[model samples]
Target: MTFQPLEQALHEAIDWMLRLEHLPASDPAHLAFEHWHAHCAENRLAWQRVNGVLDSALANLQGLPGQAQVASRALRALANPPRRQLLGKGLALLLLGAGSVSVLNRLAPVADLLADARTATGERKTLQLADGSRLSLNARSAADIRFDTQQRRVVLRAGDLQVQVEPDLARPLIVATAHGEVRALGTRFMVRQESERCLVSVQQHSVLLSTADGSARRVEAGQAFAFDRRGSMAVAPSMRTRDDWVHGRIEARDEPLGELVEALRPYYGGLLRISPQAAQVRVFGTFLVDDIERTLASLGETLPIRVDTLGFWLTRIDVK
Candidate 1:
């Protein structure tokens, strides 16, 4: 219950922050500040996370030379978000004055109630939901969840996921990604929606994939497909094995090294680059996701591939 409230506050705060940060320190925002502050103290605290995110965002922008002038000029992004302070006051009332931590808990689920969360840069997570279902997240994944009176929705503002869903008429979990939207109807399936292409592969049960333009496709279990601005296509049957990555494993059945690299990009941080000539190399079989060093080592030994490490984290794969 406590968890639910915190998450609700978090979701609300994030939306407000986006609105505030996108705007300048204008008159209407300033005039609205007082009521906003009166709203709650938790709002103020919640905004801190946005500020924290901004600090890092600014630091990154600062390093980009010409970007310094443009971003510094936009430092006001933080100033106007003072609107968040309103949420902080209300939160304080609920947590402190009301002294009903139990009341709030019973009333709301606290933060981090979502079934899954994954970090960026060499991170992964496997989550088991309340319904005896499973969801796995790749690197840099995020979702704001709402399992309300009717449907369960996972709003994928970013990231990729594979879900094993159990039957539940009360609530069916749906994942919305950038390129397309997918909903599981009591099934085990994989959904990979990057900025451009969205891939859906059903291992068992079934799924429905729909694009922004309302192009709909029913993906049955065992078959895999990918879609983009060009439109969706049934991924070659040879590339349909979707269960291989469950235990940090990648399986390629006579797949081009180029295609393999593209598939692996989201799993790795920085870059997983392949040269034009190197992309021509074909790779086969499964590799352990747990052991990047050993996996790359095995590739070097088994295939005409060279693993060139310029610096600690920089690795380039080339045809030997």
Candidate 2:
């Protein structure tokens, strides 16, 4: 009913659009966005505005020289309650061309570019640390390493990693994520930073897992745990087979179509999308991460799904 809430929702919708553009359709963020979009009339209207702006400007965005600057100014103006007028102008300038969106997208991963260690999509790496430890990074992953006299710490910025910690009584090895820190006690483990939480799976020995709230728990070998900033809140049977991805293979045992798409996203160089109906399908197999097209073709052969390609950057799956 109030213009203020509509304006707020508009801003939030734009932010969510930026994030969801790259996230898997099955991510909790996507579900949360669906909830917000359906919350009320104002929210839906705000989302409509976002889509309308993009639809109106995407095709005519060629050679808009000063559009990026104009968009930036208009976006700043929208922050001060200049809702309708400024928002309209900002979206117009921002979506006017693919170039503007390209600029913004580049700026999105600035931190990863400056990270100590990073792997691009479909790329993997094995690093031998100075402390006789081994660190393997998965696709689309970034990490920052900091070693000192007191502690050996790794800050995971995005994606997943496997760490094999060598014995070191002098310094405690810790892997830190947004949710918490996992202190490895001479163990081999895996850590994945998801949108809503961090998942830690121990392969050998135990680790002292602590959340931002100071709550701690022991995750033993053959155990997997998920936690948020509040603390270690969940435990599941460790899936050692998951580590196969480090070797360029994806092992999906009756995984949902949406989840398989999520796992394949980092390996493929495109916007891979699955329709809601097709996402409900179940997939089981080991696919090669490096050969996304072959894997998709194989999936199409066995499942009742259609794989459509739009250039080299967009792939969509829907019920046949």
Using lDDT as the measure, the top candidate is: 2
- Candidate 2 backbone overlaps, count: 2
In model 2, which range of ten residues has the least summed lDDT?
Answer: 77-86
lDDT of 2 by residue, 1-320 (tens): 88567667766777666557658777899889989888899888878877766544433333455454443432333222223332333453353333445432222222365578876545678898879899999876889999987789999999899999989988988999999999999999999998899898888999999998978999888788889987665564422226777788888787678878888777664457899999999888788877777898888889999999763345799999
In order, the Cα lDDT scores of the candidates are 0.59, 0.72
TM-score of each: 0.60, 0.66
Clashing pairs in 2: 61-96, 61-97
Clashes of each: 25, 2
User: For model 2, what is the alpha-carbon lDDT of residue 83?
Assistant: 30
Candidate 1 lDDT by residue in tens digits, 282-308: 889887754455666687788898977
